[model samples]
Target: MLSPNTTLKQIEILGYLGTKFPNWIGDDSFNNIVDIKLSGSQHCSNLPPLGQLPSLKILHISSFDSVTTVGAEFYGNSSAKKKPFSSLEILIFKNCHYFEALSMSDGQCQELTYLSIYCCRSFVSFPNGGLIAPKLSDLNIYNCPELMWLPEKMTSLSSLKSLTIRSCPLIKAIPEGGLPISLSKLRINYHQLLRIKWNWQTLPNLKNTLSEEGFPTSLSSLSISGCPLLKKIYDTKDSENKEYWRKISHIPHVGGSSERQEEDSFLNMKQAMF
Candidate 1:
């Protein structure tokens, strides 16, 4: 097998390259590559078996119109002894309209820390249980309308610190286990779950009754928007809502839709959280 140049650490394949990758593209030939970016290739129908790249730490796939599912083939041969994506830290997928599922072998992506999925309108699900990343600290999902639920056992992610979900209207609530205690920042916008009431059914009119299971005390910042019901509680006067204020008084920053900012500023602030 021909190998990449020994000095190569990063490889980027733009759309201009061709309709598909060569046969040797995702094999051990790239054993030393640390990063790979595949983007703007609308004609490509499938992804290469990138999980076999032993040293890969970052992978970015975007703008591929034909890839409908990311499954076992993308992860490589199950017979291989080495675990899939064992060294990966950052994974990103963007603008893949038809992509629907991301199925992975259980307990894969053990080293992942940052993950972001953007503008994948047709994307529907993660693995049956959830993504298993013990070290993952940041996760951002944006504009994925068909997604139904978050990863299962979210409370087990002891290292997760920042989570932002926006424009994913179908997601009804947080995972069943609730968020991990390690989370410090959270932002939810444009969701459709009014019945769950942001995990606090009585929070709106009640006094000093914050749900510990819903929002962790370790949180330093919380931002919410696009839910009319939540907007009511935050609008209360300080004197009348003393108990409500007291519940979240310890948090350093709490934002609501009332705070106005330019679109660029909003996007920049979200990026800085990770």
Candidate 2:
């Protein structure tokens, strides 16, 4: 019943707030809300109905444990076909255990630029269609041990610039051809990843390669740590192929005293090398 251009720009819905959402949210009232914080609630089963928000840019959902699923219908009816937040640029979900996966509706989140998920242990895989966000530049996944692999079509992120994955023990390898060619910074840590394979030729200006192995050419800065099995930097075959990766700045291992110290040392070495 509420119209789109309401004066409110930011809203925080807390305890017992779930039942009142559909009525509280205006059709375009949320368009100006760039930041929203939801906490201490239940019953937010799906996002607000579609076409309700045309300008929402950032959304954060935290500490809501009762939500189990999110689907396309939650955004809008099949016939109306509205996107909940077309201008949304940053989305963060934290401490949400019941949420298993998120499948974006068609033509949703076209301007989304960043996504961060933390402590959602039940998540197994990302949504289908690779959830492309043409302006998306950063992704961070942390403490989701159940996540097995990244979306296979991840290279569709043409504007992605930074990616960080930490404490995801089940992930075995980076998705083949998944890394975007426009990527400039990548950091992966605490995953059970055993191999690092990438199309080095596609990433000609990659300035940093931080992992156990498979660094490409033009890697002016490199760091390898937390990998006890990696005794050598490069295989004998690749070592002979010197056209790529003319110099490596730092190489450290987990056998050292502490991870924090080792990472610091690696950074120091990188600074010196550059």
- Model number with the top lDDT: 1
Model 1 spans with C-alpha error above 4 angstroms = 1-4, 190-195, 198-218, 227-251, 254-274
Cα misplacement distance, residue 97 of candidate 1 (Å):
0.7
Residue-level lDDT tens digits of model 1 in 66-133: 98899888988788898999899999999999999888666589999999988999998887777778
Candidate 2 TM-score, C-alpha based: 0.73
Which pairs clash (backbone N, Cα, C closer than 3 Å) in model 2? 4-28, 4-29, 9-33, 50-75, 217-245
Q: What lDDT does model 2 reach? A: 0.64
Q: What does candidate 2's lDDT look like per residue over 1-274, in tens digits?
A: 6444466778776775654466545355445666677776666665555335676777787766766556665455455455556778888888888778877755778888999988888877677767667788998887788888876667888888877677777787778665788886666652243354555567755734433445543444333345654333333244453322233423322121126776665455334333
| Candidate 1: Cα lDDT at 254 | 61
